[model samples]
Target: MAARRITQETFDAVVQENVDEFGLDPAEALAEAVEQFESQGVDLTNIVKAVQSGASEDAKDNQTHTVLQILESLRGHVGTANVDGMPADLKRFTEQCKLGFAQRYLAAQKDAYPTILACCRKVDGEKASLLAALDALSSLTDGQPDLLDAGGREFLMGILREHPDDPAVTVLAVRAVRHCCVKHEQNRQDLVKAGVLPLLTATVSRYSAQPELLCEACAALRVMTFDDDIRVPFGQAHDHAKMIVLENSGLKVLIEAAKAHPDNTSVLSELCGTLSRLAVRNEFCQDIVDLGGLTFMMSLLADSLDHQDLVKQVLSALRAMAGNDDVKDAIVSAGGAELIVMAMNRHIGNAHVCEHGCASLSVLALRKPNNCRVIADSGGLLVALQAMKAHPKALNVQKQACMVLRNLVSRTQELCPVILELGAEPLIRQALASHQDCGDLAQAALRDLGCEVELRELWTGKKGSLTQ
Candidate 1:
């Protein structure tokens, strides 16, 4: 296609009648028409005049779609690939294109969901699609959340990775990654490796008082740390994992986030959970202790209401901390058993939470059967029994509860007969009724009771009641 002179008549036709055909801005319509005209050996001067003459409120407004299309067209045009590649003339046009799209997108933010969606689809499906252009437009505006996607994410990350310390792009990339990387461990790790973690850490420490960014940073950190397969890069040579948290500054940031966002239950819960795992080292535990995290944990458990996940996380952390006799005593003194019993009863619908709650209970029951008795007295026995009534349907819960009951009996010895006398067998019957595992647990419990035959008969749906 030879560059031909675009006649003024054709250019003006495109600009004036854009709404009739393309429904786009006049400058953008004229630019695209001019590109086509130039490709066909048309004069460029007439095209420029048509574009400039047609730039009006309505033509500008209509040009938005055309502008987006131009950006899309520019994506593969090597001249605008990166900041370094941008020629001045092309850069000016790109900036103008971005401004046009931004203006239109903002005005129609609610209605522009479809346009952004289209941009994401193109970028993800095609390797060289205009993600950077769409992202730039997205960054300048708010309420265009659909722009956050794998393609949008990769594009932003690419920019940030290329320009490591550019705070503006880095900040946008971090913010974008936080909202988009929740479910993908590899993506999260990529962001971390791209120096995102350090950037986020700096933000947290610099704006130590910014609760929202701190919360997001903590969430990203929690996700990264929890990926069992991906290990944090150690800053020191002593031990990779140990160095990742201990010798380096990362752990301090986490501790500060926990202390910084005490009112943020979600942040505290995740922080405590991560800290509990990190507390395998005595030094880490001491750091946690020095930071007053243990007290925060107990208080979160006691005071934070209606947060089942937080409660469960705190309980798990407490369970980790329970190795310390003082911690165990503190838990018992803080009504840990009672709180757990409530969690158990309240989350009967969620098997995992119930399982963890019961695991925590089993931990406490093993410590002091009197606490188990407290649990038993608090309708906990009833809850566990009811849980078993469904049996193999929720085998994990039953297995955990069985463990708890076994722990209770072993510790108290006095509760075994009461457990049986209180009709726990009926639930065992329901449990075994589902599968062989239930039969095994029922058999083991009976063996523990020194009444295998009688218990076996009861488990098989016998008419005789333990109380009767």
Candidate 2:
């Protein structure tokens, strides 16, 4: 009950004592020590019991365990091996690369991407082999987006097109598409143009019961709407998001599909995040409210107060939707203000929830004076200050907490002295001094809170300076 734990050193000492002092055999001594620890109620979950080390560790046989060898073997197997049975080698290769970041990167460096893609194409009709190959492709493309070229994009769309109804195949292929699109703007535009959007919305519609498939599809859809590629001068992120919402009926499909997975925290989290990203335009923000997303998310946040992940996403959606003034008033009217504070207090240690919770409160308090008072009345100020203290190193938390304080005191100036008395000035100054991005927002928060802060001016109306 109290962790009932034993260190490996202590356990090994007892085992050695049995071997040397009691004159027992090594194997028998190990067994005796295990039995003795179990009999005394010691938990051995963390202790590494005796086991043979992996061959990769041995300097004697490095090439035998290398992923490169496995990739070559897989390529040969897929090229000639019969597809009548499950490709055991392909499955093994995928399993090896699935968990290790370095392994996947190494595999990608060995040109494993093309091999895996070709295998997926070759194993088209074989469901088991196709799944294994797709899993392998997903792993190879995890952090190696540069490996994904136009051919790989075509192959991904082909898979989705060929196996639209098969959740097993579509899920893996959609995931491969997601891994390809992240931080790769050209791929995002190419896949969306290649008709990946409707296929994704259709996947959600066809397989709402399969939460795993829906999660992948949702995540993929969200990826297509990203402008993460900094090298590109312009990105089609906004256009892709609009297509998902306007052309593909993403809102209705997602909101309808959401009905099937209310009890699942992970799926709900993804769906909330996708909806937030889609809330870019005013009418789009209103569309989320019109399509029952707002009410559903409020209910989600209220129902799943104890779930940290869900709360964080729900608060994010709320914050995004509040970009519309009417939605802002609506959120406060529905008692979302107090739920946010309560959620922050419930999961105070989670920096994500605190950041989103503060951002949501900040947006709600932007121009609405009454909402500001409602948030403050619900201990919003204290919760924010607590987050600033709890996660000092979290720049986003510091920035958003400063933002919430600024917005909270922006309209309702009465609460300024109250927050300052709780020592809000030093934290604001600390955030200001610590983060470069926090300089202006933290200073604005300090200035708005009626504290003494240095506000820099860039223009002093110098003669002929404006022309330059």
Candidate 3:
């Protein structure tokens, strides 16, 4: 076997020995050490390959050891080190990690991640110890997902299995799982394959009344359904969402959990957003309604009209659910049109709520002339136009508002004059001019509303034209 290179500690000792015993200067000793290693094909590329006076070197090294110092207490259980202090050490490390990204980076550089993972393994069965370790692992892997290797990933899942009923431990562990799989597609795929979705759904079921636990668990489930990893060409976000809904019964679980926290706006917002993510198919859209999700959203919207964040998420969920043609009818039939208009008018300045609100109207009006008339009667068309005027710079709001207008006038042509009189032409023209992507929709809205539009002639009917 080829000889392995020496460790940094060994190399440093040699350098010190060269300086003290052989009377060589620090720089000379460093150079000699480099030459000696390279001559033997030691490949010192990973080595720092630098030397400094002992005192100054140690001072510089100590600056990054604050994290590691705490782990020392949990390093050896049988020795003078107290195993009972493992939780405190882990918590202290977690707090240090929370100080900022700089501390986490320092810890990673000092090999603190493996040490923490080892500490977690050492205090495997203890509740407090596992919570502290998982918390530390979560913070340490916040922006540094690559640190969660395959073993660490399994360790987290194992802990979840061991403490299936423990809220505190599960929360901390799922948070760590979320941090690892967020931007890392590999970990997400691995975890999902290892059966993480069912555990997440079970968390919602077992702790339906626990708002904090529900939010944390829901957030983890949502992260698993994300396509945020830019490194991959395509993500299985849709597939994962389907698995959660179909294979794991995630939709029913979430809707049931949502009922437990009607007053907690934060949990409701998270639940609605996750529900939106899981609305991947027409049947799923219908399932949300069948599971009483539609009624829940309508009630939430009607009750929490003053809550802007919850309103936005509820509108977005309604928009996602409206993809089903039948649900469109259901939304209009259940007085959703009026409630949505009220929500939008109340939060007109919030571009997000208005954007989702108009899009929901647009979807609801698609191929449903009766829904269009309902919207017209409920002043949905007027609110959409107002949304367009309010968020002129928001391209999504502009595009979605244009779409709703087009759908509204598609069959209900009599309402065309009403929209035109409301000064929609200029805004449609502005949207067409400002956002390049609104080309077809803006012109279509203008045309369907009985207005003149710029028509580009693509075929000159000339010989040798490239249009052919």
Best-fitting candidate, scored by TM-score: 2
Candidate with top lDDT is: 3
Candidate 2 lDDT over residue span 128-238, tens digit each = 878887888887888677888878888888888888877788888888888888899988887887899999999989998888988898999999888889989899989
Give the per-residue lDDT digits (tens) of candidate 3, residues 1-468: 775667656777777778778999888998988888788888564355556332355574442145556655555542444577777777888887887775676577777788778877877867677677788889999888889887898898898898988889889888898899889998899999998989989998998898898998999999988999899999999999999998889999999999988899999999999999999899999999999999989999999999999999998888889999999999999999999999999999989999999988999999999999999899887898899888888999999999999999999899988888888899999999999999999999999998899878777878776665
RMSD of each: 15.2, 9.4, 9.3
Error of 3 at 179 (Å): 1.5
Alpha-carbon shift of residue 442 in model 2 (angstroms)? 1.5
User: Candidate 1, overall lDDT?
Assistant: 0.56
Higher-TM-score candidate of 1 and 3: 3
lDDT of 1 at 436: 64
Candidate 1 residue 341 C-alpha distance from true site, Å: 1.8
Ranking by lDDT: 3, 2, 1
Candidate 1 TM-score, true structure as reference:
0.54
Residue lDDT tens for model 1, 1-468: 644554444566666576458787756776677566667666563223434322455564444333334443444343332433222323333354345433334323333333433443344333223334334334433323333445555565565455444444444445555544544555555555555555555655654565555555555545455433324343222232253465446667667767777677766766666665555554555556556666667677767757877877876776666555555555677777777777766666777667777677776677675676777777666677665654347777777777777777776777778888877665665565666675666656555554543443334456776555
After TM-score superposition, what is the CA distance of residue 96 in candidate 2 from its true location, in Å?
Answer: 2.1
Winner on lDDT (2 vs 3): 3
- Give residue 388's lDDT in candidate 1 (0 to 100): 60
TM-score per candidate, in order?
0.54, 0.83, 0.81
